[model samples]
Target: MMYNATQKVISLSGGREIVIETGKLAKQADGSVVVKQGDTMLLATVVAAKEAKPDCDFMPLQVDYKEKYAACGRYPGGFLKREARPNDSEILVARLIDRALRLLFPADYHAEVYVTVNLISADKDIQPDALAGLAASAALAVSDIPFGGPISEVRVARIDGQFVINPTFSQMEHVDLDLIVAGTLDNIMMVEGEMKEVSEEVMLEAIKFAHEEIKKQCAAQVELSKELGKDVKRTYCHETNDEELRQLVIRETYDKAYAIARGASSKHERMDAFDALEAEFASRYTEEELVEKLPLIKKYFHDDVLKKAMRNMILDEGIRLDGRKTDEIRPIWCEVGYLPAAHGSAIFTRGETQSLTTVTLGTKLDEKQIDEVLVQGSEQFVLHYNFPPFSTGEAKAARGLSRREIGHGNLAWRALKPMVPVGEENPYAVRVVSDILESNGSSSMATVCAGTLALMDSGLKMKKPVSGIAMGLISDSATGKYAILSDILGDEDHLGDMDFKVAGTRDGITATQMDIKVDGLSYEVLAKALEQAKRGRMHIMDKITETIAEPRADFRPFVPRIVQMVIPSEFIGAVIGPGGKVIQEIQKATGTTITITEADNKGYVDIFSQDKDGLDAAYARIKGIVAIPEVGEIYKGKIKSIVSFGAFVEILPGKDALLHISEIDHRRFETMEQTGLKEGQEIEVKLIGVDPKTNKLKLSRKALIPKPQKA
Candidate 1:
């Protein structure tokens, strides 16, 4: 096949260059581009239907990110030996790209657009996720689709008190601030990351630093777009707006909608009021007139009038839909040990949102193994969040996990991960599951709060308790008025300009996610919002502490008992035996679970059992295998094999020594049977000598019996 590939390189601030190439791969797709940074490469393709779906009122855009095992020169680890469903990391990257590009498309365009990004090549040093957005944008830019962007995504990490762009995987280890920022040339669209109680100024500065780099990338995409002669996009009319109908709907419903937004304090009441107003407007039109104009009327009222009224009430009147002050937080209450059967359980409620979270302590065997293209590891601590339809008073049937659930779970995980102990400080694997029982707004934040309580209740010694709050921003650029709302409701999050979430302890911010839908959101406004969020977070933290001030003294009595043991590196093979025969025997005999891994050239074994007898039996066997034989030391052993000379005595679990005829006893014995020591007989013996060269131990029964004064 003939290929004509054109490439452009854009240099970043950190001496890193991003190379974009097109006209080489996936030629049948509507648009395709390969983006490379260092050794990492991503191939992004976009395809859109020629016409919009009938009766579709929303953009049917699907974004998928896949990491191929071949990219990292590894085989897929599952039963199929191929890629299956999207993992959490891949889903998150897809969401990042989706959020950045979704709004850039024409709002009325409801065509089924599918964007797929694949990591064709991976580098251990470079992160592929940060480059996915850029690749997707470059693909769209070179295509005929009508998109308003050329957006770019960059990762900024604060390491050793300095901001770094696209830091290597190793460099991220020391970062106190790790943020991924996606933006266009003019404004930032998304911000998500975790921090170590960093100040608001530092976070803002990092974003600014990231924006400068994003601008350069965006410029590169523009140049590429022009080079490909794709500056003009395809034209389509997906919406036929009736100006008269829109005006009529606004005139009849504006005041009523405004009153609904301002009058109703609860979610259900507010929704009911809006629904009644819409129905009243529909009743005014004749049945024949509504058939053709009903869709238009509903659209105008819901998207135009209702949206405007809600935003204006907050911006102009400083009155939120919930009738609370801008900075006021909702009531909060927390309870721990809600479920005695669970290792740790807590229930956190804030206003209408409630999370029932539980924590479980496990051994290393329970660690979750991750096998991605660029990363292969295991997670010792995992957090999962589930939101059922019933949680929000919906009658829809529960399906499976959605992207929102994974994203929310990930956020809560980051908030609590920093406080979790690692290495030898805490050896048990931890798993936290948060079930959103009731949700109006920010159930994820409630999950964070509930997770902290559960961890403490489970007796996991966390560094500090964490609390999270969702903050909203209402801004009017023309009037220079903006409101920073703390503990925003679901309606506020939908109607406001920004939905910002901050999670932290009393000290500072730990994790944050900011999605800005409007322009001109300056650092000053962000600082104010962050400060207000901190106050809200601290208030929530106070409630959590009131419920459980610290981690419990010990784990629940029903939890399994685990003991760690270290054995000599040489003894590891003997303990494991050939094909795990020895360890299997040990577990079967002791009724315990044992996992051994070699660290620092020593075997680190963890023994887990429910009963004390099982734990003690396993511990004893492991200790015996590592024990060294000493001369003149007495031992209780069992006879393994009876020979003409004597018998072989098994001292330790796997250690055995020779007992010759002369050393059998003080009295002479012609045969081993005369001493009455048979195979499987229990006897006491003394270690008389050990061969230095062969490591052979010599055992004698006469040494244990006192010699009769040299007689």
Candidate 2:
């Protein structure tokens, strides 16, 4: 059998080439493509249902990104020894692809589309995530699906002040700005990344640089698609449109919806008014005639009338739905130390959204362990964001962690991670949990604010307070008119052309996420949005600082305290002992927890205890274990055993020496019994000398007795 495959190669800076090929693997799928760069390869397949599900007025696109353990030549961790549920990293990648692809589908095409991108091969240098989006888009291009894109994604890193596309894992370490940008040949659709307090101008430049590369990759896909004769997409009637009903619904409801939007009422109030207007329109039809007509009525009123009214209201008038002018922020209130029992706690409320966040400090054992195929490590600073049903006034049951939760939490984590102190500056593992008690829009931004306050309340000295704001854009391509709304409401986000979130400190941006829903979104608009976001962030920062200017002077009294010490690497084994016997005994005796790790030729020891005395005792014990004894210093010793020639005395927790009878009181004794020293006896002794040949300590009991006061 013979297979026909079409391939396209895109050459990147530094002479790196990415090969995208189709028709050679997973041929039975509706669309399949293999994207390869160096040893890294991803197999992306997309399949769409032949017909849309009944009453499915929205596109149901599910994107799954998985990495096979075999890709990296490693077995999966755990008892199952197989891949389980998608990890946070995988979900984040899938979200990037889904956000870009979901925007390119035809608005009328409501088919159930599934896109799967799997990392079949791995390379340490080439990150597979940046290629996954390209692979998925290419698969769609080669299929007979009604997709409006042959988009591609690229990761741009500013290393040594130079923009490099799809940088290696090693190069990422030095990057001050790291962004994954996805776009079609004409416009940028999605961007998400973290920065090291970089300026907005620098970030904008990086995005522009990434788009040039994405355009090249997208063009290659178009070329490949034409070669395979798959340029023409299959047509399907997904919607039974009642043109008369659509126009009638718009004609009747558009004015009412516009009035409600212009009223600038609260979120629920506005929602109620819109719902009532739609219900009033449906009241004209009989219940028997409503079943089929109701769906279209709601769809038309929502997708066309309400959206248009909101966008036009914002574009025509500077007033937003909430009555604020463009670039204006919502009201904000903040409180710290709201929870007494928590190590740190805060409540941040901006407009209708509210976040209750708490901070917990723990030992090294509390760090989050990450065991993904390409990433393996532990995180000292962990942030979790949760959005419950009641947050949005929804009556549905709260299920397990959703991809939105992971993506939002990761964004907050990135925004705050750069400020969380690490290493010797902070000795405890930090965990920040933000629960959205109430939400309208930008719950993730609320989380960032709450997390910052909670962390500071916990007495963790953050480098600087970070604040985030979500910006919305309403633009008319024909009129060249746009309005950039600051601190947008949830409704604005749903109806706007862009949802752009920027998080940072007073100095510069730290993290950002943007998704463009419309074409012809210019860089100028983004620049303006970023600037407006910065101002909104600063306004929010004022509220944050008013609540708490800085981290507490110290941790609460009840909070467990951790003391860190560093010792020579050679002493690590002695401190741990055989089977961890030494460390366990120390912990049990001192009522503390001890952890020891070696790095850079030194052992880092941390002792954690709620009781100060216990913490001090554990510190002293470990200090003694690693302490090197001097020949002339005196030490309190414990008699361990006695022999005819001498008694074995422990000078430290684990250090022992021989105390000869002659050195006991400067007198010679025939037997050890004459010295009156017994096991378990404690006495003071002087470390007089060390035997060079034996490398043993020699302790003298009478060396400090004025030596023959006989003098």
Candidate 3:
């Protein structure tokens, strides 16, 4: 079949080529586009689900990241030799693309949209992720997906704190932050990034810069869509008596919902209040023909009541349901070194929110094995966040890691990575797990604080101890109504205008995450939030310090120790061979990293250990770049060899000496029997003579038999 389409190609200033084509590809799917930047290519296709996934509160959107290996000139590895499980990088990339799309999708619509990005090439210059987001937006634009899309994605980087858009891979290594912002021209949907503790003002400015670029891309998408847009076919939203039932619920439970939202100060009370309201609303539905039908009525009632109560409290009363000023924060308490078995352990609690973090130290062998872009090897440190059903005081099925868990873990990981040591800098392989015992607000930030304390407890020498705080801003009320609260409770976050989490050392910021439902605010509000966060963080820091401010004097007994050393570049090959043959030997013998890096004609090898003895053994094993000590030093020795010229003797560990013929005996003897020395013999010898220049040993058996000859 033939298709009518319009295409545009733009060569950006940095040799980045953008190919925009629509209507030709994915004619059946809702929207699809092939975005090519230099040689890197990605095919982003968007398809909306015909019907909503039942009872799913969240928008059901699926984003997949597929890497075409032929693009990288390599075939997949494994028996299947195909992509199977989603690699961490793929999951993260798909998530990155999903965040941008989620915000643009219609809010009330539950129909699902799936965005799949397939990498056709891996250009050494162009980045795949940047192009993926751009193409996905284009696909959505041309296809009749029921999305408020046409929003664009751009990467904002800071080099020496100066922001740059779409930096190359080489330039990225020097950047302090990698920020990706995806949003419409007028409103922002989402932002995710890693910062090197840049100030809030700088981060805000960078976001602004990214958003401005997004505007231009959005316009481009609009033009492209107009040229080749298709009619979007949308299924009717789930058939429900939403409006009528919602009104019935509001009329029946307005007071109860308000009471649940506004009156409850604690988690348990809130649950009780919500249950009471649910029970009260269920009374009206008892007479339904079908008993199961009551469930639907209660569900509708539960949602409407919750929504009204919260919205009324925020909009009308101007009082947060949590009873805190818009700028007020919940109380905070912190403790470190709480776990005896861990290298480090800490518990940070803000109001009802809590996270218990434990740090385990390990040998380089403990480094997490990962297969991902940017980190194709092992990682020295890993931060894992876990949310159990019990954490919310609920009885629910639990087993696998949900996407929410992975996303939260990753968020905490990115927030704390900058403060972690790098290279051969730290001797410990750190793995921290943050267990969210309870969460109301900013539990991830609490994890950061707890992780820091746990690291210190393990005896790691950090450049500085770090702490984190969740800053909250309530939007309503012009004057005294707005509050910049520190250590916000969960209710504060739900009711507040924004959630701004900042973490870093006392000297400066290390990491931050900001999300708000309200319109983007000016720099002044952000600045104030940051200032307040610091105060809140410091207060928590003091409490942590009181228990164990610094890393312990020693690592936990279960934790491992690591030692590093340098080897000659020439020795690198001797230590590691083709396909890691030699390195494997070292690992089998010493049980350590034995990692090698060469620069400026020099090689460095880092070794790790769990005990002093292991550390010593690893050192001896890899330090074998040179032969053992020289042959001759007068001392007791073992006869390892018995040659006619003399005998090869053991002088020291891994060292052998050849006893000269003349030194073997005072009388001239041509036969080995005349020397009366057997191969298994051990004896003391005198160093009557030796050749230091040639590393040859001359042992005197007859001369040392004692002065009888002289007598």
Candidate 4:
């Protein structure tokens, strides 16, 4: 028998192992790997397109990590019982892998890289996410495609201020932090994870530990690729040589160039100055050299081309693109109640980025239910962000929530969740949508600011108003220079190395997002950016208050009104009878949602109706259902099963009263002959002093009789 296959397996620390065999499967793919641990196995196959998509400005790198129910030895439930769309957790994992490989790909080369991670097993201890990233990188490395040598993914867990490297599912229980960082051997490129609000020191330590463990995994992948790697062709992107023209340009106009970069504020001003500078530099060169030197010099100095300016802008001089001084904020304009039809609406724009947020408040029934791998719970406060192609001066076909969009929307959602008011008193389901009509930079942060205003405009009484700003770091390795720009603009962000966004209230930070395209940054950079972010956030908040200081006194007229009420145990049956007949009638008549939270001797009823107008109407409408004894009121009574000493009378439909035989006819009724009273007889009775303690109404029929005529 002839076998066309080979196999390789490597064991890792912490009872984890990477069992890989490539020759046995998918040989047609550019590169592929099957990684398994126990029953949990993932087959990652990658293929790069021979030709790039037409009319595409950027490379098409599609990384999809999907989970099949059958892999877990189960079938998907429900009609249309199949897996179609990727769950939220799947989208997040796909994004993590995408970040890891993007840095390794060459800049000029635009090719399609599809990494499909199919689950062939299901062992909870060995999560496929970290391995999926490694497998994707390995596929690219072993393929004929050119990439910078090996990137690996690492998962870090922290428990009690201690970092655990490549932690298992069991260790995650005690962990307050879950961070997955992907980086090359030299530095990190992507970081994405969720934390339970841990300290910065602990967080930093965890990242460090993750990087260390990742190196070993990175090593294993390198070894495997060497054994089975295909010959990869190389394509290099063209870069200008700044040294060749630096001296010439400097001698000609260094003094002038410095002035323009320092003094420029608006983008147009910078463009004008850069154009003038380009012309001056081009004048000093010969026609052929001019063609080479002009672009080289412009590339080294212009906003789009020159990235070293980050260091110059930050370290040498604390000059930002918008000309804000250190610890200063850009212009912030906030307007609440912008949309009349929405429950709550606000528009928050800081500098170039803008987010129009609208809040919709609904009953508990309005909360969305999500069934996913990572989370199976109910969420009351939801924040959604939408970034259309036009927002960034681009045009493309419409597609549902992509990885980038989901990640950004989730970041904004986390930043604002802690500020939402909660508990049984205000058990409302709130949703905030921030439509990014324009995005220059920090659109995610803008969503936070606008969402806060919208919630307040809807009279949500949020715990605190939140504002966010995007901080950028521009480093010049040559001069050991660095600059941290507050509220960075689009051009600055695109050219800069790091996009650090911070959001919170005046007191402390609520959420933060950090993404870098450079080597791993020092804690010093993170600390400085965070400190500066506070200043920027507070400044923006000061501006926001000028527009709307606090939440409105009343909720939006269009929003729903929810209230909680308690009723006696005896009335519960009358309110909700056998098969919910009474409750259904109550809902049909008053158009309210009555949910019984706790029912016993005392019951709590949660009522939800649209607006205070509807709420007040329902309140007046349903109060009579649980009607109690009221003094000085008259009610019809029926003799129901009369007794020897007193007659039991039904009053007000459901209430009952006692009639003594002495008052049967203003005199004694001997053997029930003189009174002429029968069962099911109805009569009008006068209400006396109702026992306030018992809530029972007393009535007297003799008092309404002709007693004055006898006197």
Best by TM-score: 2
lDDT of 3 by residue, 491-571 (tens): 557655677777777666666666655555655776787777877777776766776767677766776666777766876
**Each prediction's Cα lDDT score?**
0.89, 0.92, 0.72, 0.73
Per-residue error for 53 in candidate 2, Å, reads 1.0
Among all candidates shown, the one with the greatest lDDT? 2
Candidate 4 lDDT by residue in tens digits, 278-314? 7866776789876656655664555333344433665
What tens digits encode model 1's per-residue C-alpha lDDT throughout 1-711?
Answer: 599998989887667888999999998888999999888899999999989977788889999999988987889887889989999999999998998888788879989999999999998788998899999999999999989899999999998998988889989879999999999898988999999988878888999999999999999999999999988999898888899889999998899789878885688888887888888888988999988888888899988898889888877878878788888878888899989999999999999999999999898989999878777788999999999999989999989999999999999999999999966677789999999999988998999999999999999899999999999887878889888889988878887888899999888779988888887688778888888888888888888999999999988876898898878889999888899998899999999999987878888898998888989998999889889888888999999998898889999988999999999778998887688777898899999998889988899888777777865
Candidate RMSDs in order: 1.9, 1.2, 4.3, 7.1
Residue 633 error for model 2, in Å? 1.4
Q: What's the CA RMSD of model 2 in angstroms?
A: 1.2
Question: How do the candidates rank by TM-score, highest first?
Answer: 2, 1, 3, 4
Candidate closer to the true structure by TM-score (higher is better), 2 or 4: 2
Model 2: runs farther than 4 Å from truth? 707-711
- Model 1, CA-based lDDT: 0.89
Q: What stretches of model 3 exceed 4 Å from their correct place? A: 1-5, 10-13, 50-58, 230-248, 289-305, 311-319, 373-375, 472-497, 519-524, 572-638, 650-657, 663-669, 676-711
Q: Residue 36 of candidate 1: its Cα lDDT?
A: 91
